[model samples]
Target: MIQNGFMTLWKSSIAFFSLLLLGNLTGFAQQSIDVDSLEQVYLQGNFAPADSLELLDLLSVTFQDPQKVIYYSETLIQVAQRQDSTQRLFQGYLQKGNGYARLGNQVDALNNYFEAANYSDESGSDSALGSVYVTIADTYSMNKNNDNARDYYHQGIALLRETDDSLSLSTGLSNAGDFYYGLGQLDSALIYFEEAGPIFEALEFRIGIGYYLGSLGMVYGAQDKPEQALEKLNECLEILEAEGDYYGVAAFLPFISDIYEKQGKYRLAVQYSERSLDIATTYGLKEQIRDANLQLSELYEQLGDPGKSLKYFRQYATYKDSLSNIGLVQQMARLRTNFEVNQKQSEVNLLEKEAEISELRQKRQDAALYVALGIVILAFMLAYGLFRRYKYIQRTRDVIEKEKARSDDLLKNILPEETADELKEYGRVQAKKFESVSVMFADFVGFTHYSEKMSPEDLVKTVDYYFSCFDQAAENHGVEKIKTMGDCYMCAAGLPFPEKDHAIQMVRLACDIIDIVSGDGYSEVTGFEIRIGIHSGPVVAGVVGTKKFAYDIWGDTVNIASRMESGSQAGRINISESTYLLIKDHFECEFRGMVQVKNKGMMKMYFVKRTLQGAEEVLLNKTTETGE
Candidate 1:
């Protein structure tokens, strides 16, 4: 085992060493070709010139190598078309558009960004649309078209509500704020800057927060509050210092110098202005350095140094015009040429391709006709076979419907309508303990004697008649029949759904039973008077079984209720004190105090007096307690 383990370890070590060697060799091969080109541009702070041009040249060269560009663009489009996600499609268009934009193709970039917006709209991806909107807005801003830039900025803000991307929203807000500041709308600029500030703070976007604060400070400076402006601008510097954001520090310093210039502190302004120029030059920010030089020129003039002011002013103008020629206007002209060329070529190619493709399809159509005919015949045979299967399924469905109806009827008989609904929805009913549910147990007095006297047929007939009367009485009183055991009838109120007037319902059910039995329908047959016992207390009721299910009540309340029924006189609804308390006010009930009957130490009872006036009084009897 030790030898085998050693051998395995040696093999693993050899494999790892071989993989490392291969990776190192590949890395070296890549390093040998143009590695320093991108690296030097990034490391030497040459992003404004070389890095931008390199990216543009790379995209232009790769476009003719269609295999290279097509992998990214075509794959993105294919996935976007196949999937239902519009956001993903939007991202694909955004990336493709960015590729075109990098090659100085603004027209294609604009078209693709609009396409992204459409996809994002369909997908409800407001955040993704916000990104595309920001890009379009920034392009317009860079071209100095402030009106179009501000319009797109508001549209992006509207889209930002649907997305929780604080970083992106803050960036867009900061840009819009700066644009407003440049247009001299100081108050509107402050509002945008402040709005963006909190979002950056919440997201912990340190760089974005610093920029918004600096922009806000610039707005305050314009509004003539140098002290307030200085506070915000200094805080901006503190954040940049802490974050070591040299790029941000370069951008913000010139604005801080303006705040000093506004406070009549020309010396301090000149000092800060020189520092801003140093940082901007260090970071290769030529545009920011030009702004700093202009500030310094004004500061020198304020300090009574016209000679130095003129020198710096000349430097500022030279840098400004250089930036305009090489940076903004030149890029715009390149974009215009690319746009016109692509637009004309694409339209011409599309029209030519459509006309040329309409001819070779006629010969192929003649051959496909025979194949289509054969396929139609095969489809008919398959459809007829499916029809026979459908008929057999219909017969099975009829049997299922009948069984379902039978089950529904069984459930309705066993449970209350509401209780049945709850059981179906939740799959089971929770057992509840009712402290004052009225239970009524009725029995045919001398039922055993009557059974002995009558023939079997006559006894069954009499019992059936008695049961039917009991069921009707229970139904009329809104009580549930528990079940009939031999000659005794059991019913309950205040469950399975509880009611405040359960005792009343029970009393009515008991009285109805009595009235029904003594009526002319059964008076000629010589039936025995019924005895009823009512009790109120806590009882646990629940459905218990895996296969054969039934709802049952348990505990001492049930037992005491049965005892009350056994001890009661014929034609009386005898109830306990608990039941009496609930229903006594509603009915003419006579108290039967302290009855000594069963295991219960002692219990108060009541006699329910039958009201003769009207159905209203009898209905009130349903509320009376029969004390036992």
Candidate 2:
């Protein structure tokens, strides 16, 4: 069976953007390149600016050795920097990233890509930005972060779409197809490659056209259309071989072999696999070598050639172990540590030599030495005082910054931004009497008994879950949440800033609050319901305490709201007469008659049935498909 073997590695390093960057350059990149000849020419250093960049671009894309690619890319970067060529600089960094990506050094690869991104951004060329993003998408794709890969691909393609750069846009499209191809979405993969096909053909970009054909071939192979698959694969293989892309040739040979193997043509599969292995081995393409060996081993086993299977399996294992970058990582770590140790030793030796020179000078002239020593002492004391002052200033600024951040966080989290700003300016919040304000209270029905059945952790989680929903409902309807006391949630509107439709807003919020607990899964979730209440009247609102500040209201409105909640039935919204009168036009309410409250005597209350058709709608996360 076909697998995601070195397809990821192949796409990550030698994908369309690799050549896309080269082809877009205004030099010899559009022509066929003899990379060995170019390398020979580069070895005989110091050419004209244009010629050097052109040669480097061609060699960067054609080089089979990743280490050599990196070395040349560094030289390219220096040349670009000296010439102040943004385009060439971008290509240099991108080539370095591609080399690292090929070597499985993702950290360094991403670092170089981001460095290229900075240049791309500064260049303000959408095509440049798109190319880098596509490169980044390849790296992320190879890493199997599918979500980030898709996002980056979309960003790259979108940006490329806005530019007149057909070549770069085609690169983004085909690579995106490769992304979906790896994900096994054959149809999606085909669509992208097809979309990119005409662009490549129009530009006469042979490499791009080959990749497009190859991608389509793979999709057809996966779909079991062997005739079409073989035709496309063979056509693309010819193009790659002609272009001297040995890496692509080695990578695509296995795809052709997979198609033959799936068709039960064992001999043809073996021939193709061997061909891939030979080329991969010749070019030192480690990933392709391992993949080809494994493919042959599996094919041999299927053909009943146990001896060949065992031999190829051993070879595969050997390459797999040898190809791991772990030892390389450790070697780098060792080099870094040794460099640091040597640096410290050099510093120590320099200090010792300075001390010896000072001693000799002191022995030569005692009076002159004393005078110099006194000057040094005075300078040292002055430096010490200045250093202390600097330290003190820095410490004070740090403390102020930290305290300011903490205070800002506390203020914004606990209170509203406007309220926080007012408190900051005045150092105290004055109680303001709002003529009309709507207050709401929602309590979980039978929560006390529910808590008894659940563990302490589960109990808190349950309460928090329901209360959080209530808070969201309140916030969505322009209701300001005051606080939550255990299972009860309190909020108000028209107080922090007066809203004319506070009563209507609160009623809609109450309906949403009921909706949260009225779901079909509600009984299974908590085995309980919620009771909501609303009232409207004058209320004095302000921050109450100095240490533990609370923005609370003190009036009959708050009391009535609490009484309404207490008098409410399970899964119902109870409203005081004052609230009903204000919201009657907006909501349907059932008269519940005058109910006697504990301390406040009898009060007229009504149950809010549902909101009117033209009224404000509830916006809770628990809102259903039916719009209930």
Candidate 3:
């Protein structure tokens, strides 16, 4: 319901409070150590490297000035490197990235973020890596790179949820909601926002609650529930203002402007827009400044104030250009970082060899003293070794990915995707009874007698060929191929999961099987013909056994399907009355009146012909004839 036609409000969604719940630790430390006192101690050079890094980390996020944050972050990095603290190094790079992001240098921001990821990986901390992903997602979202934002958001959430970092998980959820909110996906936005709210409440994080409520409010406003929206927004504003989050306050006020703008209240809209502009300018929130300016420009134009509109429009244009995407720069940075990360990795092998070679050279130094020759030879050996290693790693990765894909395909071949997922996730698949499903059975007319005359290879090849085509036919019509018993192929539609058109799918699959064996010169080449039978009724379906479990169906429906196939003539698809009724309008069928079926006594049967193909085909034919 949140249409893109409305004023963009604050282009940046997600409050600082909700952006990094991990940074709340830094926030807490800053509170305990007064800024003025910390600044005096830091300036006096009285603190140890650890204390200095800690102070710098606190000060980096404390200031609203991006330049100051960047300055502090660089110092933090130096001290952290001196101490060999991987966690500190990650934090330093992260804070630097945040600074660049605030200054609207997206390329530099992304580069720093990727650099932070190196240290996060080095630390092998899920929480740290998750935080990095969330931060990168925020940057991507700010620049309107939605696909990257969505990918990172999911990645961050996946990792964070696996750890004990509730705050990080909640923040990821809230930020993801904000990303969806920006894209005007209100329902998805609401889902994440609702999920995050309870987590923040349980943690008693007031600022998190404020931001969570604010996003929830924005989603509601977009949904056209003004009263509910205003209530939450007002509550959010109160908490944020109390916490003195100037950027947060500035970023959200324009949302109020948006509601007013949509309501056609130009004066009220302009008032909230001006309020946001004032706060953004004071706090140096560039994105919010741009957004508020743009909002004001449109509101003024709505009110016929051309002079004010033009002035604000120019400001909007200036900030927009500065904040625009630098995709090429980012791509180059990404490539450079990827190469560096690969070289530094433990699995690279070359680095370990270099270290070993260095130790060997040191031991031989006194005996040979061929330093320059050794250097040249070592360089040549390393270059060749590294080249080979890189090629090996690339090939290995390609092989692994291909094998993984093949393994997945093989698993899907053996079982339904949903069932496979369940089996993998829980180590078992539960049997379920379907109220209505379409079971199908197809059999080669005389496989046993023909196999006695044919060679073993020829028999196997013919069975494989027919079965392969049958598999494709089943897949095409969304039917599940349960198994093949010698000459008989058993399948079912709507067993693992219920589908509305299971009967239709089963019938189409049966016809396709008939076509494959009878119509494709297959009979002439292989001397084989098939009969297919379909019945629609209730059945139990699942994977059973342990050593060589198979996905199979049971009950009277399957038995009747087998009977139908056994009684059917070559080159024909036989169907029970249950299936015939479901496909009556879709395909042409010949009613055989009543027939004696074993165990079931008497049942109405039908023989299927070419597809009537349902109402869609009729409509297409009519349209083609009239050219309308």
Candidate 4:
């Protein structure tokens, strides 16, 4: 027991001394890597292997525990603050952002990149700005904010172009091309990759060239040019192999495998896919690992190896699921952040509204407090002023109202009252679909001879007197005046408002017009008489045009109505077969068999003689029986 206790005590003593020595050595190492020296060494690009190793060692010593990145960043920030060159400070921030990105702290990385970009922009350093934009784009890309990443890549490319930096431009172009490729815009992807290839080749940037070639090859494959795809992919493989870039080689192999798979070369597909997976696993490329697993899964399934297929498929699904979960987690985080941001914005808006409300309330309170005091002093002046103003306004408004009434009456005279009402309510009225309407056409018989016999003034008076009689008939029969052309008058009924007796009313109006012209009021011409026609059918009526508009009816109905008037005899009311069918039972009509109407072939015309007599006929029959 004593021996075991002594051994324990001795082990503890030795461990304590070893820790003490380690602490002393660490402190000494830290003192050697002073902030000034670090800034100077990094600025001059004089970081040798040993120098980097020493800095890394000193960092370990400074952070003796597994400290948060913020703790380490604080130390770096202090060192950066002591540096005189803005370039060094930007580099410090960029490096810090990259570290945060590696640690999956996207917000911190974004903040650092933002700061770096601001400093670079202010300093007019194109290269620095380009680097900052690239870093920011990478962060956004990691989160699959493709839109933001694409925009930042474009900005970076523009900034790099200003510096004539081929490498930065090539990188930016490659990234943009990759984004386009992912979005399935093969044309855009090809253009950007082609732009990047020349620049990368000029700079002898082997990795950039490989990436561009691979991307171009994929686009070619997507474009269904297999031969071109194989050529490009082979060239990419050659470059990747020569550069000994295992990660790049791994990446290119999968693309080559894709070409083989597309070509139905399953054996080659399996071989290349396995090789890519091995290389990727060795190099710890998670992306290549995932892709290789998926490719193998498809290859195995194609080869009909169910067991192997299932194994690879499981691996693929597992890794894919993990990646998907990670994406979902990141998406959830972003959504939570956005929700918080929205909540804060809402609160800010609410506060602003509250402030406005408070300001209004204060104004109202002040106005109320001074109301009694101001009213007594201002009453007499306001009352007299208001009275005179009111009187002037009242008189002016009365005149305006009278003028407005006159204008309204004029409008009613031009259009039907219902149409005027619609125009006023809707500001502008739409054309109505009138299912059916009554149309009438009237022309004076032998008016030309009558006009020749009279003087010019007398001729005008004679026509006016005739047209006035027709107008009165139209008004009595509830017909809307369509228009009068020379001595011919046309009127329509049932629109802009519809009526059940539209056809009957139109027939009555026609008879009235004929009767009035044939009466003793026809002294201007001894044998003066008017021929009238009426028809009823579907018509479209609408007020057309913005200025100088008129309501017009169009359809077969109106055309037939005009034909009826043209086919009428003097002093006769002619109607088409359709009109005769509707009004024949109500009125006495003589069927003028098969009148040749234009475009109507042979139409049965009727001469509307007069309305039927029921009560008079019954009375006459009873009297005849009684007398007999």
lDDT of 2 at 261: 83
| Model 3: number of backbone collisions | 0
By TM-score, the better pick of 3 and 4 is: 3
Ranking under TM-score, best-scoring first? 3, 2, 1, 4
Error of 2 at 305 (Å): 1.9
Candidate 1: misplaced stretches above 4 Å?
Answer: 1-70, 73-85, 90-370, 416-431, 452-469, 472-476, 522-528, 618-628
Candidate 2: clashing residue pairs, number: 0
Q: Encode model 2's per-residue lDDT on 1-628: one tens digit a residue.
A: 5455534544544443343333333322434556677788888875775788777866776675689778888988998898898988988898888788778777798789889988999999888888788878877777778898899889989999999989889878888998888888888988899999999999998877888888888888879899999999899999978976676688778778888888889899889989989998898888778778878878888888877886777677667667675565454444434445697875666677679979987787897788899999999999999999999999999999999999899887688677888999999987789999999888888877877778897776767777777777777777888988888889998868897878978887877777777765333354578888888999998898899997888799999899899999988889999998987765677998889997989989998776444333433422442365
- The alpha-carbon lDDT assigned to residue 203 of candidate 4 equals 78
Write candidate 3's Cα lDDT for 1-628 as tens digits.
Answer: 1235334435454533345444444563354456677677889988885577678888876765678889988998988998898988998898888777777677898899988988998889999899889888888887778899899999988999999989778878888888888888888988999999999899987777888888877887888887888888889989988877676787778777778777887788788889988988887677777777777777787788887877786677666656665564354334444545685563455566579989998889754767777888999999999999999999999999999899789888899999988887898998888999998888888778888898888788888888998888788777888999998888899867798878877876776777678665444255578888889999988898886878888899989998898879898889999999887866778998899999999999999876536435644754675597
Every candidate's lDDT: 0.67, 0.79, 0.79, 0.69
- Residue-level lDDT of model 4, residues 153-214, one tens digit each, is 78887888888667766766666676666566878877888898898789776656776777
lDDT for 528 in candidate 3 is 78
Off by over 4 Å in 2: 2-62, 325-628
Off by over 4 Å in 4: 1-78, 99-111, 317-628
In model 1, residue pairs whose N, Cα or C atoms come closer than 3 Å (at least 3 residues apart or on different chains), thus clashing, are: 504-622, 504-623, 575-626, 575-627, 605-627, 605-628, 606-627
Backbone clash pairs in model 4 (N, Cα, C under 3 Å; residues 3+ apart or in different chains), count: 0
Error of 3 at 152 (Å): 1.9
